[model samples]
Target: MIEIIPVDTPSLGDRSYLGTDGEVAFVVDPQRDIDRMLRLAERRGVEIRHVFETHVHNDYVTGGPALAAATGADYHVNAADPVAFDRCPIEDGDVVEIGPRTRLRAVATPGHTFTHLSYVLESPDRPPAVFTGGSLLHGTTGRPDLLGREHTGTLARAQYASANRLARELPPETDVLPTHGFGSFCSATQSEVTESTIGLERRVNPALTRGEDEYVRSLLAGLDAYPAYYAHMPTLNRAGADAPDLSAPRRANAAELRRRLRAGEWVVDLRSRTAFAAGHLAGVLNFGLDGNFAVYLGWLIPWGTPLTLLGETPGDIAEAQRELARIGIDRPAAAATGGPADWAGDDKPASMPTATFAELATVRRHRPVVVLDVRRDAEWRESHVPGAVHIPLHELPSRLHEVPDGEVWTHCASGYRASIAASLLAAAGREGDVVAVHDDYDPHAMIARFAATGGSGLARHPL
Candidate 1:
């Protein structure tokens, strides 16, 4: 029996699957989560024989080489696309045998990337299973504009043809296992479901429904912005390099950290918002080593920016380094040597501005205070506190004129965006008390308290 193990990298939140049959295993789209894949291989008593990338992924750095290094697995890519890795380039119809009975055939499915390919698993008796990386998803198709707008139309048309090829050629009963599920930026129509059948997707996926031209047009429309860091990912994957050893992550004491900071090094605090707010070294930018940590870091920190990490845990520090490497941001000066609390010094830590339910009730009972909900438009419409000005964090820098020059209480679904908004207001020389509100606090009570008592106890003044 063939066993498939899902390796979910919390850093990228990208799911990579490992397929095993006793003595041999094959890994698909191995992101930076190598330990889990190794453990899975060990549990099955198998050696990883091959590492496959469905396409040139932009969401996170590929871990194909890392896995290959640890397992002696041969890396595989599309024969058409010339990659610089030590790979066994396979064309459509090329087969990789895992055992005396089981094999995987490469199926050329270009369009997600110029050289994208899917794999079809065959084992004599049962129907085939297609492992589509980004070319074909359960409910949606991979976005066509990843390369650029110049080739978007060409790529979309190619992707459409490829999808049709699979729909027509692959058996209706083939089980389709897609790399990216719903909520992935890779596919425009990622489904909530992780797996589906070729026949089932053929009936439901919009990318497979219309004529070639119309389908291409539909795919191009409403395409969201790819993360800025994605532009550098393909090259990194092409030239597979060893990931920096995380167990021996570079560490520096407070004095060294201060020296580096002065010498143009950036301090990246990877602690959670709550931990960061409680007490953190001054001037360190908090990107909380959470979801899309690297994506935002690429935007906030300049390319090739020297970094010093202040993570909540050692694992968190390692994850920060891995995320940075995925996007080719590999230079880290060091990790903070001491714990976060130790670095805070003797100054009574300033509590992050917050309002209790009772305080909010009194504020809402009074007048003159405005709550600025700096969440996305969709979030605001879903359900938001009344009397809140909706301004998305991305738009906040440009739309500062819209916010009234009065005491403004800023909030997002949580306080993260609000803190960012508050910082922006301070930088803009705005003459208003800008306070970030934590999501855990009751908005109604805070609003009412402001109405009753005129404002929260915080003073209203310019930065």
Candidate 2:
């Protein structure tokens, strides 16, 4: 019996699956952390014999090459792709044996990427299981726009054809597993569920149900901007990421951290957003250890930026490092761990300034305050403060100047991003003028919040 164990990254809601018939196991679409898979192999008393990648991943760094090297297993990728690093190049119709009753057949499913492959596992006396990397998903298909604005239409068409081909070619009872559908920004829309059979998907998947031209148009329209780090992933995955070092980062003294900050290293504060807003170092930015840590860090921080970290404990620092590794940020210069007391002997505590929604309204009325709405474009278009300045949180550091010289109160759907923006706004030294509204806000109800305050509060009216 083939035992399939799913290794899920809850932070990103992405999954990698492990399949074994006891002695030999194969991992599909692994994250950068290979130890989890290794531990599973040890637990199962099986040897990891093979590692397969569906495509060059754009969301997180892949574990395939590193896993292959560690276990002396074959790491497979598409033969047609121009990967700089070595891999067992596979093509359509090529079969890979995993065990006596199990083997994987590579099928060309070129929509997510030009050379994407789906591995179909054949086991005796049972229906086949297809690992549709990014082709056909539960409710939607993989977004084709990751290749860029120019290739969107062509790839969308390709995705439609490929998705339909999968439905037609595979048996209805075939088990369907996909890598890109679950909240990874790779899918055209959020997948309703992570697991679905080919039979079930055919009945529900929009890509499978819609006409080819209609599917293409709908997919293109639904495509949203993915992380900027996505643009760098293909190259990095092709070249292969460096082996991860999960060891606690070397310790840096407060003085050294100060020096690094002066040297312009990306000084990151891995603390709770609330804790950070209450007290954090000047010029340091907060990305709470909770929330979408890896992807946002990958999205906002530039590629290969030298980094320094400040956190509360060894575990906190380690977790931060691991999250950073998820997207190929393998190294940080050093970490300064412990509370504010460790960093400041007796200096006054510092905090990222914050304001209440009511205080924000009061501030707005008294002066011309810039209500910076740091939500996504869609969220902003849906509804935001009537005269709020819109700049998505990820773009705030570089676009800080657009905020202008004024009392600025930042906000997003929830206060997570608003806190991060508040820190950045202050770190940019807007004359200590920025503050965060630490409240859970529904974008649609923002106008009502203003209207409830009465007297045309910042262009107040129901949205």
Best by lDDT: 2
Model 2 collision count: 0
What's the lDDT of the predicted structure labeled candidate 1? 0.71
Q: What lDDT would candidate 2 get against the real structure? A: 0.81
Q: lDDT per residue, candidate 2, 69-116, as tens digits?
A: 899999898899888778898999999988888999998888888888
Q: TM-scores for all candidates?
A: 0.81, 0.93
Could you give me the TM-score of model 2 versus the true structure?
0.93
How far does residue 180 in candidate 2 sit from its true spot (Å)? 1.8
Pairs with steric clashes in candidate 2: none
Full-model lDDT for every candidate:
0.71, 0.81
User: What's the residue-level lDDT of 25 in candidate 2?
Assistant: 92
In candidate 1 the C-alpha lDDT for residue 10 amounts to 48
